[model samples]
Target: MHATEALRRLLEHCPELDRTHDLVRQFASMLDARDAAPLPDWLDHLAVSRLPALDGLAKAIREDQHAVVQGITTPFNSGVNEGRITDLKLQKRIMAGRAGVPLLRHRVILMAGLRRSYP
Candidate 1:
């Protein structure tokens, strides 16, 4: 009936798949928790699980261990700055043929709500 039920039916006869599913859930919960404390144990499990697909991921996690921890521990990110830059680029592209630098500057200023109203 549902996707979850279908998946359960599919994995019902496969012990290996059930084990894989458990490992996947554990990793997912660890990621959601954003605490690297379980990472070491997770990595060990990954190695022991003998899943070739996760080998590259394990290596990547090991290589970027510090950055990953910082990402999980800190609430800081460049998302806002990146979004602003993306908006500017899109605006520039949309106004490319219809206008020049001066109009583009005015549009950007207006879009940013920086244009002053006439008194």
Candidate 2:
């Protein structure tokens, strides 16, 4: 059976999976059948309607790629690192920053080790 037909059968039996599987199956069939059957009129209309949003997304991706290539954007999870830094800042404030860096480092290390040992 064609991929589309198999997908239709699967979707009919398991509607809970949503349309993602059907879309993937349809895309694969489209790639394999190159110049085979044309898409239905409804799908063509939907694609036209979504073209602008897709183009914007493509543009954003290109800009992001350029930034990465130019070293303008650091490849790091700033959000996660910032959260850790914020926790460190809170620790410093609680101790009024009176603990030297070494003592602070030792405290953090001990806390992490205790968490791991207990957890």
What is the C-alpha lDDT profile of model 1 across 33-84, one tens digit per residue?
A: 8777888888778777777767677788889888877776677878667866
Top TM-score prediction, candidate number: 1
Cα misplacement distance, residue 88 of candidate 2 (Å): 1.3
Clashing pairs in 1: none
Stretches of candidate 2 above 4 Å error?
Answer: 1-76, 111-119
lDDT scores for all predictions?
0.77, 0.55
Model 2 C-alpha lDDT versus the unseen true structure:
0.55
Task: State TM-scores per candidate.
Answer: 0.56, 0.29
Q: After superposition, how far is residue 11 of candidate 1 from its true place, in Å?
A: 2.6
> Pick by lDDT: which candidate is best?
1
Q: Mark the 10 consecutive residues where model 2 has the least summed lDDT.
A: 68-77
lDDT of 2 by residue, 1-119 (tens): 99979877887887544344544455456545542243343244334444555345445545564442333223333655575576577778889979899988877776566656975
Candidate 1 deviates by what RMSD? Answer: 8.2
